[model samples]
Target: MTPRTPLAAAHAAPLDLGGRTALVTGAAGGIGRACALRLAAAGAKVRAVDRDREGLEALAGQTDGVEPYVLDLTDLDAAEAAAAGADVLVNNAGIQLVRPIEEFPPDVFHTVLTVMLEAPFRLIRGALPHMYEQGWGRIVNVSSVHGLRASAYKSAYVAAKHGLEGLSKTAALEGAPHGVTSNCVNPAYVRTPLVEKQIADQAATHGIPEERVVSEVLLRDSALKRLIEPAEVAEAVAYLCTAQASFMTGTSLSLDGGWTAH
Candidate 1:
């Protein structure tokens, strides 16, 4: 069995999220859903936002302290409204399109950048004042390993994620004096519906078998040779939102199975 990191032990303390309002974007799927459930389990009043109404409702049904909202991150105004009064904001909405820069469509590139980078910036900007006034806040942005390292056929994703890291760092510095913390959880290829779809898309794009896509393409970059779990990502988010982590901000906690170790 693999050993847990010291940070994991530090994050194991119990927290009462009761009475605290948290807004999670893309909460209908994968890592976002996991984070929402974890927050609700810790007694947070979770507002789960997603573009899929049915999925959001389904997730809300399974957990207490959770409310569903169907809103697209592309709608900056709607996102701002949904984020009002939230003590903790998890910017988790993202999309992937695997293609070379030469073949990438201009519109698709813009959309990906908008969702991953622009939306989070706007959401943070909207939430900052409320947090500042309250004198307490937490912002957890779900970035990716792609943010730290580059890969072929993912130019736009790479660019947006890299930008997100820089933004998070800046936000953390500004929020430090206000008792607000901003950080990011950067995970490698996680075993989620989105990743499964990416595997298939990659297979089709490269004329390779699906199995090869997992082993050769995804795992090829990781020293640990395994896909990161969604729960692990959620656990990290939970840690960042705790009181003990108040002094910890503007950092990236990598859940990449040692993807960047080399």
Candidate 2:
């Protein structure tokens, strides 16, 4: 017996991303901000990308090893270029427009698809070469409950998330042979600016008061009637980067409070 391998030593070691480079898009705030900080804490140098220069500057002020890269993901070429040479790629940038399909502006729909779906494809494409050469990488796509289910007046968001899920799975299959893993983290109604902005829109769309939006609309299907914090979602993203999750790819880790349980 090898002294039982020392349970604490074998199983309780902290996640260490020492010397790794992590590229996180939409890192100016919310989930992306949380992820940047979390990975930095784990000893990875984080390349934080976003269009929000002020926000990125603010984020960089709070941490060491976080380099702010101001680039809007809608610029497909730039988005791809920014992902080069990253050991970890977190595609977490997205925008939403809550409007019925019939009322949706075609230009906005195109923009939504371009930013949310096409940008991730380009980023993953850019990341794979470096990852494959090194034979290890982690890709985490921050998706939403909308990726699996749908709600009225959220056509563009639903479409983008659905597309993201498909893209993530495809990457998982292709990258498996190269020691890279791709996965999605689907969270519902996070307590972030995105969700905060949606309250008024959802209220108008559902013909309800804004006060009722949280309880009656957002949490209606959730078994746990609460909004998830950005840090909570970031923890899941961090887990996927660890060795324990090496075999878990091409699937979604839903932090939906059982929204999909039904």
Model 2 lDDT tens row, 100-213: 889999999999999999999999999999999999999999999999999988888899999999999999999999999999999999988888889988988888898899
Q: After superposing candidate 2, which stretches have Cα over 4 Å from the reference?
A: 1-12
Give RMSD (Å) of candidate 2 vs. truth: 3.0
| Cα-based TM-score, every candidate | 0.94, 0.95
Global Cα lDDT for candidate 1: 0.91
lDDT of each: 0.91, 0.94
Backbone clash tally for model 2? 0
Q: How far is candidate 1 from the true structure (C-alpha RMSD, Å)?
A: 5.2
Tens digit per residue, CA lDDT, model 1, 18-68: 899999998998999999999999999999989999999899889888899
Predicted model with the maximum lDDT: 2
- Candidate 1: which pairs clash? none
What ranges in model 1 sit over 4 Å off? Answer: 1-13
